[model samples]
Target: MIEGFTSSLAEVNGTRLHYVAGGQGDPVVLLPGWPRTWYQFHKIIPLLAQRYRVIAVDLRGMGDSDSPLPGTTRRPWPAIYTS
Candidate 1:
């Protein structure tokens, strides 16, 4: 919940992905490392947003994004995020 930034959810690849976006210009996507959520970039988002359209996403099963069903392991990551 950083100032000037807004969060939203998008349905992609049959899953809902959560993201926080702000600013304008060329796009910049931020993905947190393992065991972390978009909040990991909360401190740097505003700075980056000053010069680019920053999008910090909560990967599936993290933060506000939906979790996959147990034993599910066939979904392709790139397809889910790109499409």
Candidate 2:
């Protein structure tokens, strides 16, 4: 057997974000796509736990977090876009 990690909810910028935390290095924010859950990164989490403090989160309207109605486009976008 092995030690376990933890998951919880965090309210950020009005959205209730669900997150899983582990490891012990620089903060690494794992932002998923619009329709995907944080579980998509389950495979990489362990590898990351070896070197980084991994934090995988379910974006607003996805997964364990609260799914609210659509909002204006002025809000934040996923971290993938380089603009």
Predicted model with the maximum lDDT? 1
**For residues 10-71, what per-residue lDDT tens digits would candidate 2 score against the true structure?**
87556677888888899787887768977888888888888888888887667898766466
Native-to-model Cα distance after best TM-score fit, residue 40 in candidate 1, in Å: 0.6
Clashes of each: 0, 0
TM-score of 1: 0.90
lDDT of 1 by residue, 1-83 (tens): 99888989999877899999999999999998867899999888889989999999999899999887665557666766777
Clashing pairs in 2: none
> Please, what's the RMSD in Å of model 1?
1.4
- Residue pairs with backbone overlap in model 1: none
lDDT of each: 0.88, 0.73
Q: lDDT for model 1, on a 0 to 1 scale? A: 0.88
Find the candidate with the highest TM-score and give its number.
1
